[model samples]
Target: MASWSEAVEAAVRRHVAAAGSPFTRQALIDAELDAIVADVGSAGATPHQTLSRELQHLRDMGLLEFFAPGVYRWAGSLDEPMRAGTSKGVFVVGSHSIYQDEPERFYRFGPQWLPNASRIAGNWIIYQEPRRAGPRGYYAVAKVERIVPDPATEGMYLAVIEPGSYLELGRDVAFQFDGKAVERGLLNPDGRLNNGRAVQSIRTISDEDFNRIVGLGLIEDEDLLPRVDDPMPARVQEEHIPWEGPVDRATMLVSRTVRDRQFRKRVLDVYDCRCALTGMKLINGGGRAEAQAAHIKSVAAGGPDRVTNGIALSGTVHWMFDRGLISLSDEGAILLSRKINDIEGVSKLIYPNGRARLPGGVSRPDARYLEWHRRECFHA
Candidate 1:
């Protein structure tokens, strides 16, 4: 009887030498084991049982991970799972395994000895006309053809490509898929999957591809791809408020950019969705009209890009407040900048001139940034 280590090494070498194109476990039993055992003078003429036992022992030692039943691969040595933050998020480490049974589903199996595989399954994104009804959802399953990151979204994450999404092959031609496009029988069809019923599958175009398409005049800015956090400012009446002192154009530009999408949501969440300027509450209509994230110290002047440095303001008040035309005192009083009083034709703008609403149970703005804005940006 050969030593366990020697037997395992011999088995691995034999498995490799056969050079099967689509390597399957049965191939090992059919060719390599019989020849190797005959040469090794092993007592057992048939080495399939011995090889199976040895492979199981190797799994116990953590050298390999079983992605699916009877499927194995090298376990990454140094990778370990890490906690994301104080939030209930976790980061996992695993390998990208291409399933041979179902090609559409891509799976990532963790390195733990469990009965079932723990993995992130591919989901289908269905596309249909706006009011059209049917099975409108994405189904999660194990099998993936391609994975790429979406740059337009805030957090960096990968999206698995689903079949049937439009693909442009040449300058003026496009191809669409109806069936499992990639190689079939690559993944288990009945395995765990995520079905995205409401999410629509739009064809993914890479940034580079988009630039090329734009250069060719295939699409325009209005038809540009929708980002994950694009902000559409609801239209409101413009207020022409008089300023008592000089207005700062640079400061106003900086402030406007800060109110853009990236910093808006966090600021709104920090402020509990109430307008700091008017304390206006829109409990109905999904709270869309009342509150918005307003930058305390404008993005142009090096203010931090986060909720800690933002204030929630109503749509009407945010415009008047941002143009260096208004501000808030440390005592939380409304301070209409002198620019407001000095400028001609500015008195018509509706200004929240008295007690300003402040966010509940939140820390006040940093004095340094606020002072900088007041000294450099405030019209007064």
Candidate 2:
């Protein structure tokens, strides 16, 4: 069995890997102290003191670096390419239609950035929308699996995204906060902005700055929580002020606790708690919708958590949809699989028009995801 100190170090490693680098002592304690105490069953030094001692020991072993009096940055290895001193990067994108960018699958780039993108392969990267291109600033995160030449476009390459690693930010992060650039790497030594670096299609990101952006982008929003049949409020106010100190809230970005909540909220809100297939809206006494958020591609299949990849479905309909008993076309036509035993009963549960009741505008399901469901999940 591992010693108490070894067990604590192991727990600490898990937290750092999930949360990314640059964490505070208090945040570390809050995230892992209870688990350590439960596992160790009372140490002479107290679980809190034991954690503190191990943190300093890890720092002395060159696995962590002190960022401030109370803050620590992870210096240990998380994986092969994410080891200490390995550089990550950012990928600048425009409208998906314009660049043929598939945010969940791959990023398209020109030969100019081939070298820069190569450096960050096998690591994580942030997706940004250029100022004049669109409103979203730092919008999402993904891990790059590899860099491959784009067969469709000459002199271009695609950064193949790691399966299931792409996650849209809970909130779009601004380029600057309180007159200071969030990406300090874009600022010159004299504090003037570097126009060249600012516009680069791909650029290296310091771990400190990367953690800061991830912390801001993943902060939970109560307004995005799941609601019943109520329409979402017209305007939800947000604060753009970025944290100027240690970044401690980075891990939950990839946590299912955060992603599932945001996904359910966005999906149900757009559908107005009505089943897309049956047009039935059922609310419980607590005012929660009976409809559940069903993913078209599913997380296990490398689908993103974006609303466009989700649908609101009654519990029975969701089960049928998941098991290939039913599916949908790009045009929202309901497709019934021959494998379904009670086709007549299933047919009665659908809308009279035999089409999905999709939300208006951009909230509707994407043709790519719908096509994926039809080709990959549908029995017919």
Candidate 3:
């Protein structure tokens, strides 16, 4: 039989897995802890205290984490579970493996050693090998057909790609994936990937990097495009390309130029192109885009370009939000920090009820990132 602490830990893990998000003490009490209340109190801690201790135990054991004092986030689905402070959909080291059954397809196991591969089986389109191996590559982008696990193996996940889905760089030059930059591509400054030899095969790439990598040009053939059904990989003329060179404006615009547009489109579409804080959906003349995509975590701080990191805003509200004049709460409440001394100006622009509009589907801002804005970026 499991000890009381282990039982508590299991209950919390189940709660997190079921909720599909973080969980809190209240949630635990209401959902799985009610029956065990007396048992918990017998251990000298109240239900709340027992739960807290169990959560701490989990933290120590690297099972789950405290997003806040009461909240815990768990991604118990990936084959290699993402670590704390890392973003979702990041690659798992040592997860990518060659398919013994079919050479055309590759395996990417993740979130855990024996993870439920079905969580991310569908709805993903592309997968890119992060490292640039040998002389003839940077990344090989592939289209995911489905994910499967070896029934005999625990957490053995595979992101199976269509044959010929990988786009290759035939040229000799390779660039590494920075958090969001490819400065010289030799290796990232932050060291997330060392010389493109990150141990994992390939994890799900986030939307921001997906868009960026899709636009990356070859060193010799700058416009090489790959077809998934083609067995012959697209190859540019192999050339001796050095790590550092004078990049043209077109080459440098790949990530930001393409991704920023997608970010703005997603943000504005979710909010109907209205400013979430002020409800201003301004249209100048033609059907040109007027709403801007503003990052809750600014680009300088390494925020991904996914819709969750952005909000649709009018010009003035965007300016104020970026400068820390305003922030959104974890509960979607619009918060003007203590720095706003001009009450009249702020009040005229803000929503009377003070709630930032939530997106309809999955575009809801991560409370973790929202809390980050409140702590690091908000004026208060």
lDDT of 2 by residue, 1-380 (tens): 12355446655665775576687788877886754544333445566676788788878888789999898887765432222223577888875446778878888876545545666787788988866654578977888888887889875678898877777766778888778889887776667676756777776687778888887777465544445333442223334667676643334456675677667776887898899999999987767678888899978877898888999998889989998888998888999999988988988999978999888676689988889888889999
Candidate 3 structure quality by residue, lDDT tens digits, 1-380: 12356446545644654565677778877887743432222334466776677778777877776788877776344333222211112222212444332212545443232222232343233233343343222323333456566564553556665443333222212334434344222123443334232332332334454444445533322221222232433331234558884343223323343344445555666788788888877675545445667878766665655567778887778778888888888888888767788877888787888787778554688676688888897887
lDDT of 1 by residue, 223-269 (tens): 11122243543322224568866442212212223224334555555
What does each candidate score in C-alpha RMSD?
Answer: 19.0, 15.9, 22.1
Query: For every model shown, what is its TM-score relative to the native structure?
Result: 0.31, 0.62, 0.40
Ranking by TM-score: 2, 3, 1
Q: What is the lDDT of residue 204 in candidate 2?
A: 66
Off by over 4 Å in 3: 1-254
Error of 3 at 339 (Å): 1.7
What total of clashing residue pairs does each candidate reach?
A: 47, 1, 19
Question: Lowest summed-lDDT stretch of 10 residues in model 2?
Answer: 78-87
Best TM-score among the predictions, by candidate number: 2
